[model samples]
Target: MSSLREKLKTLEELQQIDLDSNEVRAELETLPAKRAEIDQRVAEARRAYDEEKSRVEGNERERRQLESLLAMERDKVKKWEGRLGEIRTPREYAALSREIDIAKKTNDGQSEQIKALVASAGELQKTLEGKADALAEREEANEAELKGLEERQAAAQQRLAELDARRAEAVKRVDPGLLSKYENIKRRRAGVAVAQVIGMTCDGCHRHIPPQLAITLQRANSIETCPNCHRIIYAAEAVNPPAPPPA
Candidate 1:
């Protein structure tokens, strides 16, 4: 029969591999969402730039329309002024004066509209320039961040594969019966099938182990389970210990 102590040691090694693999797996699962978040930021930045660009373009078009209307109004005023001398009746003279006045007022209003549009367009242009610069910088930074994240993801994936291979090898070194028991307990106990006995305490539950059982665990010859957590218990010094200081 395989020594229970040696079997437990193998189990401990296997458990460590599982723990390491689990961490890498968890990181891999979260990476996609992280990448998506970065992508969303980039998309929002681009949308902002496009919106500003559209505003500036719309202002320019409106300014052009206002200029065209102003020209038409000025032409009407000039024609009416030329016709003022030809007016004979007092009513006709009054009608000609009213037309000229209306045309001049319209021209002045259109000039003011054009002026406001030009000023607004100038501000919009400056805003668009700043946004473009900001967008460019953000895109560059996000690209670098994404590249680094992808590299880390790749490395984590590779590490998981290595851990899996190591776990397979480690499992083979343990007895089949013990491995079966460990797997069953691991499923029921949050992936921790083994626990270490520290002094007289079960590390799994921080509960005190019976004095006799503690002695047996210290002997490193028999397998034992913690009464509180039922996890396989092994001596802490057997698995790891603080290295002694240089003499």
Candidate 2:
């Protein structure tokens, strides 16, 4: 049997081990979420780039089509002008002149269409430029954020490793049977294996421990368990009182 003080020390060490394990697990779990957020930002930027490129290409295609129509109209006008002097009679000449007027109108309409397409192409180009710049900025910011997250993850892992090493040392000081009991209870209850005996109350459940159990706990130097929560119990000098020192 160990002294009450030694047993309390062991329990405190177990609590520390539990705390460290929880911290390590929490840090590990957060890494994936952080990486996912950065990846999402990168994906959004890539999508913006692709959309901009598509819009620019579409506008270029429309502009090319309008230019082709304008060229056709101009060629028709040129041919009409060439035939203006070939008429045999005044009525035919007048008819040719009317045809020239209609051709001019058609050419003017085509010119207007070409102008509108060019303006649209210019607008699309501007949009693509703006989107491209935005994508680049987002990419840079995301990269920096990812780097910082990775550094934090590395630091967390290092601290966890150090804590595990210390926990191994702390475990060596406790009895094997006591350590086994602590591990079993910890696995069942979330990360918490030990409870403080605080004035006849089980801190694990905040319920009053029976008077008999309280008496046993007050005197125990070996492993004890809480009847209410099944967590290991120990009398804490800070959270529980100890017998008066001898004079």
- Give the winner by TM-score: 1
TM-score result, candidate 1: 0.91
Model 2 misplaced stretches (Cα beyond 4 Å) = 1-4, 87-106, 238-247
Q: Give the per-residue lDDT of model 2 (tens digit) for 160-179.
A: 88888888888888778778
Candidate 1 wrongly placed segments (more than 4 Å): 239-247
Model 2 residue 82 distance off true place after TM-score fit, in angstroms? 1.5
Clashes of each: 0, 0
Highest lDDT: give the candidate number: 1
